[model samples]
Target: MISKTTIDRVFETARLEEVIGDFVQLKKSGANFKGLSPFTDERTPSFMVSPVKQIWKDFSSGKGGNVVAFLMEHEHFTYPEAIKYLAKKYNIEVEETERTDEQKQEADERESMYLVSEFAQRHFADMLWNSELGKAIGLTYFKERGFTPETIKKFGLGYCLDQWDGFTNAALDKGYRLSYLEKTGLTIVKPDPNNPNGTRKFDRFKGRVMFPIHSMSGRVLGFGGRILTNDKKAAKYLNSPESDIYHKSKVLYGIFYAKKAIAKEDNCFLVEGYTDVIQLHQRGLENVVSSSGTALTPEQIRLINRLTKNITVLFDGDAAGLRASLRGIDLILEQGMNVKVCTFPEGEDPDSFAKNNELEDIVGYLEGNAKDFIQFKANLLAKEAANDPIKRAETVRDIVNSIAKIPDGIKQEIYIQECAGIMNVSESVLFSTLAQIGKKESTEASKKQRQEQKAFDVVKNDATVEKVDVQYELERKIIEILLLYGNNTEKFEDLVLKESETGELVLEPESVEAKVYEKIYLDLQEDEIELANERFRTIYYKLIEALNQSENFSLSTFLGSLDQEMVSEVSSIMMEEEKYTLHNWERKDIYPKDKKIGVAQLTSETILTLRCFLIKKRMSALQGETREGTQDNRETLEEIMNYIQLNKLLNQKLNRVLS
Candidate 1:
């Protein structure tokens, strides 16, 4: 367990901007910083980070909390992992106490999985650097691919031996659970063919160079292995299957490493392979990430969109996969990303080119060669179409469809003009086609939205009706005042309702528990009644006890007295509004309004209001009573009229004081 001292240091030193800046590009927006939502694909900024509050709110996804919570949400980090991350960021040494075996056994499944994954990462890394076969084969292969020692270590590159059960045996020998190994897909388990009820295990990535896939916070989630040998039947690459912890579709290669740089550069370089990422990073272009050679997914693009809107995708001219990969540009556009495509020279990929040339030269080549998506598409298609009208028409449709994928109207218009210019087609004709596709898409989107709205409405309407009670609102307002003005020591008396022997209303002055809102409400009531807002009411009682028991109260100490949820809610409310300064009123030549000045006048006004309400309530209660000009009812009506006239005079006096 992390020590209290360690936890205190973490909270004390952890800066919101500094911690979040490691993964997200945040631009100053008023007192808070705003960025693209990490949890969704958005062009416009919707994620907000408040340095003063040490919290973030993602308007798009509606997930919000402090730094620890952000880490838990975005990186899937445990509380301990998040604390340790902050500690490391602030250079605070952590102190921990050892736990018993039973206590360790009580660790949650997620934490255990995280621990097991970390162990596996270290195990593979050790094998890569230490094992004879690993050094001779995997290390040799990495070197042959022009990967440096620093690059290999930076990426946490590793290797698995050729032995069938090598990794599984090692894991078991270390007292790690065999079940977890099978669960993580590090080991393949099968029912023994020879034995009736027994199972056999083999390493999943035998004789493969390992690449550790990490969560945004850098915890090892899974592995991606590349084959070294020229085995025709064997697949060239293998990834860990989906498990309780890792989802392949949501994970991107090099995100953990590239997130900071991507945010810093305000752009991300999208590539196709793990090598492409490693090579670019080696060449000091650390803002590059790969889709792991898969088709660009909305999830993957969203991940990049969190860090930046601008994306430059690099494709190799030598590779036969250009046309197959071109579809990704449309996906990028759909996510409202600014996409540019760059192609390396024929017979060269990013990896080879980086190795052959200096970093400056490589960067310059990429910058110079990067072409806007529409222009690249038009130029590539123009070569194929030549002067054939039919082919040109097909190309125009393809470009228009790509433009239709863009969610932004301004970008679509700009791309349309560019496409027309490149295709030698009229802007009007191209726009007409774009309009048709866009209209269809919009109609479908609207239909989906309507369906979703209907579902939402059904759910909303199905909710049980809650009875409206004004008493709850009154109690909440009282609590707000108590929480705001509780510290003031000046004597402030409030009127409480009391009942006399005749059951007539009587006003009594009460000096009650300061900041004890529930007590204040109870004290005011002629009859004892419990207030709603149960959580605050509960807190109010405890605070009263604390205040009565102690000579002096500290706001922070009082705040620290509650559990996490209560603290969060109470603190948020308390800090939402600033203290109204009498200084400002004084500057405007206004005197501080004495809170008690209107008390006598407000008393008459209150009686008048209550009389009106009581008369109505009584009338409702006496609905069956056929009291035709009865003496009691007549006297009640006459008394109410007199009180209303008196209230008019009271209002004039109160208004004069307020003015």
Candidate 2:
């Protein structure tokens, strides 16, 4: 467990915007930061971070909380892991109580795999720098590739010794479990046929140089290792097998190092391998990542989609394997992102190309040579289809199909026109082909939907309608009001029933000045109203106590005291109205009512509405009792009448007509 003192210092030092900005591209909105939702595939900015409140909200996914919550959600970190990440990021010394043997044994399985992978990375890097054989074999190979000492260290380059059990023995000696070692694919184990109960083990990447693959948050998920010698029996490059923490299709090499730069430049350079990423970064080009030669996946594309909508895929000069990568562009288009292609000179790949040129030459070449996906695909296919009618027709269909993958209608129409011009076909012909492709796609999608529906035996409904939960909304509003204005003293004009000089009961405005929390608590207490929602009721008491005890209640401090569930509740409530402030509502001459202008009125009305709702609920219960019960009919009738009168008075004070 992390010490309270250390967690507090981490919370104080680590800024929410700064930590989230590492993975997201945040642009400044008025008083807040807005970005594309990392939790959803979105084109518009729906993720909002309020530095003032020290919380973030994803309007698209409805996930909201403080900085720690963001890490827990985005990075999939356990609570302790998140705190430790913050401590590391902000340079705070972690003070954790020593774990007992039982506690150590109870650590999470996925986390155990992660720890093994990280330790392997360290062990390999240490061997590369310290061990004699590692220096002679692995270090020499990286130097021959023109990587600098600094570049090598920056990427955590390492070497596994050639001995079969070198890494396995080191990890075991350090008390790392063999199960995790095998699970992360660092140590491969096999049954020893000679002895029934014994097993044989070997380092998976023995005699190879290691490149650590990290997640966006910089935790080593796995490694990609390159062999130094040309052993025909063994593969040239070896990657960690898919485990709990590392999925090859989902992990982008160099994403941890390149995420900030990718967002800053609003573009990404997609490459084919590990060194391609390192070479570019070493040449001062930082917004670059690779699929590690794996075929592109939607999950990987969505990872980049969270940062920017623009991608410029970098290809080597070799025509082989070029068409395979071209298909990945259509996947990008499906996600509503822009795609461009840049190829190096003949006989040069990104690694060699960047290794030879200065940064200026590289930038100029990429800028001057980058082709839009449409032109690039057309030009490449036209050469192969030269004068062959069948191939030419097929190429045109392929291009049109790629265009059809675009989600935007306007872009589709514009690209169809552009493709017509490029292929020397009429626009109408291309449009017809695009239409056919879209129709086929829609039909297939509907077929799949029907199949899924049949499998689940779900009933078809005309619409998915949701009725309003009035009590739930009222309880939420009460919490929102208390959170936003609990510390502020406001003048309130509440309607009080009084006897006038004419001896008739009439509602009169009774003015009073008190803190917002004071008014809310007193009103609820007076009515003996308990929140119907259990979660809201729990938060209600906590908020009231915190507000009453502190002269200055800090929202950040208050948030730190609650569990994640309540923290999410408070953040959503406080930030719900702030979403209207995004996209600059006033500049379009459509101004929303400023919430600060009438906080007092809002608070009074909310309390009045809750009282009305509860009273109506009580009257409904009494009516039900009158129907179901045989005794006490007169007293129950009088109780219903009393509740009805109270409900009417609350509705009147709220300026609502009772229907």
Candidate 3:
């Protein structure tokens, strides 16, 4: 747990623009900042950051929050993780409260696994730098690959000793649980046949160089180990088993280092190994990542898509390897992204090419050699289908199938024309083939949509069957007003309806000045109407308590004391108007009548509206009782008539014309 003082200091020191600008490119727009939405693929800017308000709202996705909330949403960091990230950025010291042994034992399962993985990374790195065997073996291998000491350390390279239980024993001696170690795949356990109820434990990556895999926010999720010895009996490379914290298909090597570069360069270079990424980054081409020798998955492609919409895939000169990886291009096209392909010279991969050439030469080679996916695919397939009509026909069909994956109609037509010219076929023939493929795809898409809609209908029907509390909206509105404008003080006008000597009601408006909180509290107390929603009621009392306690209230300070759910609610309320602000209402010839211009009138009207609603509700209940003949006594009759008169007066004060 983080200490309250440290959390407060962090909230005070971290600027919203400075913290979010690390990941996004924000341009100043008046007093606020605007940028393309990081959460979605948008060409026009919809993400806005307000320094004055210390909150940000992405109008495109409806996500808004304070500095810490943005980190949690953007980086998937837990509350403490987000706080620590900001604290580090602003050079604020983080002081954590000591946890009891019982509290430590009760930690969450996923968090425990992450803790073990983090410890193993440190342990392996220590071995690589400090251990004699690690220096002789792991450090020597990295040096041989032309990896500088700085580069190796940057990637968190490490080594595991060439022993059966070196890592397992170290982790155990440090009081780390074997169960967590095994769960993280850092240790392997096997049953011992020699002794009943006994198990044997060994390190999984013994005798290898370690490459720690990190999430986008730089949390160590897992490790990849390369065996140093030429042992044909063992696999050349080993990876951590899938655990709660690591999903291999969803992670890409070097994303943590490459995300900013990818966003800045507006393109990514896809490679096949960890060293390919490291070597190229060392060459100053920082926008590169690898599939880590696994087949590219849609999840991995989407990860890259978040940073940019263009990808350049680098392949070795081997024709067989190029052909084998050609299918991955269609996956990129399916995601509605532009893809280009580049192949290195014979005997050179990304690592070797970067090592053998200057940075400018390597970059020039890539730019000159990169070809659109369609052109590259067509040229390669044409070579393979030389002088054979049947083979040529199949190549055309294969190219058309890839073209169908493209979602943009204009791009598809352009590619179809390009294919026609390359294949010596007429444009009409290619278009006919494309139409057949499109029809089939449409039918399948319609079927999927129907299934999804049916599931949605089931949920909608279930929700409709439940009774919805109507007063919940009014209660929520009251809370929203309190959170956004509770601390503000302004002049208010109270309209009083009095009985004249002629026995008629007369309206008189009187001017008064007070804080909004004081007016709202007194109004609610006079009416004796409690908030109808439980969540709203809790927030209401909390806001009142905060107002009474603080001499000058700060939103960020108040937010620090709230739980995650309440923080989300408060942020939503505070930023709801920002959407309209982003739309530039002036451009649309629409102007929002300024409610703040008459804060007193707005507050008085809001409270009167609530009172009138409650009065009408009471009148209806009394009418029901009168019809049922359940309460027809003289006193009850008088009470019913009196409520009717009071309802009329409230309606008049609210300027509602009675029918």
Question: In terms of TM-score, which candidate is strongest?
Answer: 2
- Per-residue lDDT for 324-355 in model 3, tens only? 79889999999888999999988889999998
Please give the TM-score that candidate 3 achieves against the real structure: 0.90
| Candidate 3 displacement at residue 379 in angstroms | 1.9
lDDT of 3 at 346: 82
What residue runs in model 2 are displaced by over 4 Å at the alpha carbon?
446-467, 501-504, 578-589, 624-637
Error of 2 at 204 (Å): 0.8
Worst 10-residue lDDT window for candidate 1 reads: 575-584
lDDT of each: 0.75, 0.90, 0.86
Better of 1 and 3 by TM-score: 3
Off by over 4 Å in 1: 40-44, 59-62, 446-531, 538-659
Clashing pairs in 2: none
Ranking by lDDT: 2, 3, 1
Evaluated against the true structure, the overall lDDT of model 1 is 0.75
Error of 3 at 329 (Å): 1.7
Residue 641 lDDT in candidate 1: 55
